[model samples]
Every structure is written in C-alpha cells, then in structure tokens.
Target: MTAGTRGEMDEAPQQLPGWAIPPSEGFTAADLDRLPVPAHTQLIDGGLVFRSPQSAFHTCASYLIVEGLRRHLPGHLRVRREMSVILGLRQRPEPDVCVIRAEADRAPDQTAYEASDVLLVVEVVSPDSEERDRKRKPQLYAEAGIAHFWRIENQSGRPTVYVYELDPATTSYALTGIHHDRLKLSVPFEIDIDLTEIDAL
Candidate 1:
C-alpha cells in the first residue's frame, strides 16, 4: 500500500490460503523478507506492526535532522533513514533515522543493518507511535547495546528533540537534554542545531 493509505494495517487472518502459513516457531527477520506486508510495517517481538502514514511535519522533521547530522557528523559515520536494524533473532526495528559506523563491513546490497554497527537510533514520535517510540524502542535499543538514542516530538506544534545516552552499568538511557529552539550536543558527536531552522527547511 502507498503512504497515506488508510486500513493498510487491518488484522490479518489466522490462516491464509496459499503457502503463507503462520510459523509455529515464531517470526524472524527472514520471515519479514518472505511475507507480503505494507512497506511501513516493522517486525517487532515476532509480530508485524504496521505504522500509519507519516504526517508532513513528521517527514519534514526527519529530513531536517538527517541533513543536520550529515552536515555536522564526522566522515566516519553514516546517516540513514527507514532502515531495518536487526536487534535480535526476533527483533528488527526500522528507526526513522540512524547513524552507524562508516567503516563497518556491509555487503553492497545488505537489507538489514546489524545492531552492533549502529551508533545511534532516532525515532520521530507520531500520535500513533508515541508508546513504542518512548518506551518500547528505548528498552529494545538499550538491550541491543546501541550507544545513543533520540526521540523527536512535537512541542506546542513545533519540533523538539530529546537526547539520551546509555549508561552501561544499568543498560538504560539517561536523559541528556531536551531541545526546543536550539540543540547543542556533545555525546556521540558534537553538533549544534537550531530547531526552528529545521522546520524552515
């Protein structure tokens, strides 16, 4: 289904007609490749979770953040969007934006990035995905040992960024800062951004 299409996430039948039998051993990353699902769907904890269409604000904010990171981040890191990150045998989540070590070995046509290669993962909170982005994803990313996480939310109708750094001893994130107008961060890399400028783009 195309973006902005409603009803793409309707519940699937327990059993299908053709060779699409539900696996008894639970879903895996490989299963996502074989199954026919909406393009925005993610495989989370052995279930197919479909994301609703992104709003204009969501898309614009994601683009601006990626552009900001690319301009400021060092050459040794690569920024990407909507790429599936394999966190475990059964958990492969697609973050809105992600940064990874540039030198990490990857085939020319790798479909999913290994979690170990990821340096940071960013999720842009939507009305439908607030719970997953705020709670569920942080827990999963921490478990996968991803060093950094960022959550973007709308604050009074403007984009705001919340930054986090993983504390290894606890394997949980500590809030680093919350940005509204200006965002200057030192961890993961130093970058200063004007939040208002992001939306202007």
Candidate 2:
C-alpha cells in the first residue's frame, strides 16, 4: 500500500494456513541468534516469516512514537525498535517497538531478554501485516503477560492507535481505547499525540 501521507493502510490480504500438524522441533532463543538477519525477515513461532521492508511513513511513525514515549515517559522506561525479546526458550519475537523498565535493560550481554522484562510491545501495521499485527501478535504478547500492547496503523490519514490491557481470563487483550482524532496512550507512557502530524508525514 502506498500513501502520500497517512491514509487508511491498504493492507495486503492473505490468510495464514490453518495448522494441521505440529512441528517436530520448535526454535529456541539460541536459534534466533544463529539465524542471520535477512533483508526483510522476522522470527515468529519457531519459523522465519518473510516480510516486506517498512514504508517511509511506517518508519517515520515508529520513530515518532519512540521519541514521544521516551520524552514523556519517566526515567524508568526504555524505548527501542527491532529489539529481540525472548517470550520463552522457544519463542523469540523481534518487535518493531518495545518498552522495558530501566532495570530490565541492564543485562550485561546481548542475549534476548525475556517477556517478563518487557512492559509494552508496539507494532506498526503495514499493508501486508494486518492479520499478524491485529490478531496473531496480540495473543502471543498477552500470553507473555505483557501489561500493554499497542497497534499503530499509520495508513489512515491519521494514525489509528489501539491500546489494550492484557486480560488474564481469556489470555488475550481487551481493547481499552480507540483514538481516532488524535493518539492518546496512558500506559507505559503518559502521552498524547496529534494524529494530524502523523498523517502529515
């Protein structure tokens, strides 16, 4: 999808094949490091999912959120992009954006941090990633007990921000907000953003 500025993202529609048989061996955290970073690929569910490169608008929006979160959040919060987070020994997801408390970011080495170390996870919805971002990922993050999950759809002339608080009962997330006029996020970071600026990008 191509947008002059920010318009409703023209997401590429593709349904993931239903699971029939489980894999004999799932990937581990160590496997992630061994797998070379490709041109446009991410590790998902013990598999390498190929994704298209992010668009200019998406990249800008991600940067905007990171900067805003950093500026508005307390000293304890750390904002990052493309950070490898290990939800479990068998699960390592490289989220587009993540926020972890100061202490969690204190690991002495490059080992991927665990989900318990993450406070929030954010994904920039791209044309080809509608399902993964809106559906698959939320479930995974929720299962990891992440307190906050955000989906930023930058295609809409204005960015559509979906805020969720993990629900323990369903092991999923409940949409806590739908910010149409502007972007407002209260968890992890207490900040409000004007969608007009996101669209103008």
Candidate 3:
C-alpha cells in the first residue's frame, strides 16, 4: 500500500521457473500428468523425482527381466516395463518392470496402474538411485500391498536379484531370497531365469 513497498517489489529478483520450485506440500499423483515432467518422472512422498539416464547394465537387466517374466506369466498377468504404479495420492513411482493383473491393462492409452493391480514390481539398481531402489521405494511398494518385489543389484556387472514378499501384518517387506547367476521363483507363478542372460545384451 506504500510507495516504498511498491519500489522494493519492483526491484526484487524475478521469480524462478515454476518447475524449479517445490510445492509446500509437494506434488500430487495427478501432477505427474498435469506437469511437463520429463520421461520416467516419479512422484515420491509428494516430491517430483526425475530419472537419471539409463546405463547399459540397467537396460540389459530390465530387458532380461521383462522378457523372462513375460514368457512365464499366467494368462491373468501381464508384463510391462518402466510403467508407473500409483501407490497413493503422493506416490506414483515408475518401476523398472511391473507384472500387473491382466485386467489392469484396460487400454493402450493407460498411463498407470493402481498399486493393488500390480503383482510384482522389479527395480534394477542404478548408481544414482541406490537409496530409492534399495530402501524408500520398496517401503512404499510394500505399504501399498504389492505381493512380490525384486531388487536387482549390479554385482560385478551381473544382475543379482533380491526378492521379497509383503508381510501384511507389519505392512513391510520380508526378504525371501538373494539370487545370483540364476533366478528361480515359484510364487506369483513359476519362473526360472538365468541371470547371465544379461550377458547376451
């Protein structure tokens, strides 16, 4: 209301780009679609998280898992790669691979699936996302009640799969096994994949 106040406002620095600012309460699941986020953008705890460029190891491991899973999936399940799963209003994460209920694939235009619709979510570890791939994400996925999860670590350029199952009583994941060289699992359906398959990539 005062001339001095108006002059100060005019002299102030210009505002930052809208995307550069973090909302007080962070972004919502819907913001992922409404905003001009880059490819593979994720919403974590209401914060926007962008993905780092993929490494050869990441690409190879993802391919091996996606194809391997697809081969063994029951008719009721479908395999999708790098798809977003909506865990909550503030949590929309794009797992490296998701084995979802076949019914969840309602249309080719669908951008995401509800957490409940996902039977398994696999995250192949990356240098930039170690913490998330190892900890934060699995926690959210468990809380969202995804039945099975696998965290693939790059061990000496080979994919090492760490599988987990959700423990509903505690709302957390219980590590079931650490697989190397070969991955064999029966839950969520039977599948045997030679981890060395990545070597072909």
Which structure among the candidates has the greatest TM-score? 3
lDDT of 3 by residue, 1-201 (tens): 899999998896988579847789888898888787888899999988888889999999999998899888899989999899999989999999999888898887888999989999999999899999999999999999998999999999999999999999999999999999999989989999989978888
Q: Candidate 1 on 1-201: residue-level lDDT in tens?
A: 755464556656567544344467668977777778767568778777887988888888899889889889998999999989999988998999999998664777776888999999999999999889999989999999999999999876578899999999999999998899887888789988778975566
Which candidate leads the pack in lDDT? 3
Instruction: Give Cα-based local distance difference scores for all models.
Output: 0.86, 0.74, 0.91
* CA lDDT, candidate 1, residue 100: 90
Of candidates 3 and 1, the better by TM-score: 3
Query: Higher-lDDT candidate among 2 and 3?
Result: 3
Stretches > 4 Å off in candidate 3? 1-16
List all candidate RMSDs to the true structure.
Answer: 6.5, 10.0, 6.2
- Per-residue error for 150 in candidate 1, Å, reads 0.4
lDDT of 2 by residue, 1-201 (tens): 458433555555766444322257865566656555453355567666666877887788787778767777788777778877877656676778898877886656665667888888988888888888888878888998998898988644457788899888887898899876677766656887766666555
What TM-score would each prediction reach against the true structure? 0.87, 0.79, 0.90
Q: List the residue pairs that clash in candidate 3.
A: none
Stretches of candidate 2 off by over 4 Å are 1-23, 107-111, 199-201
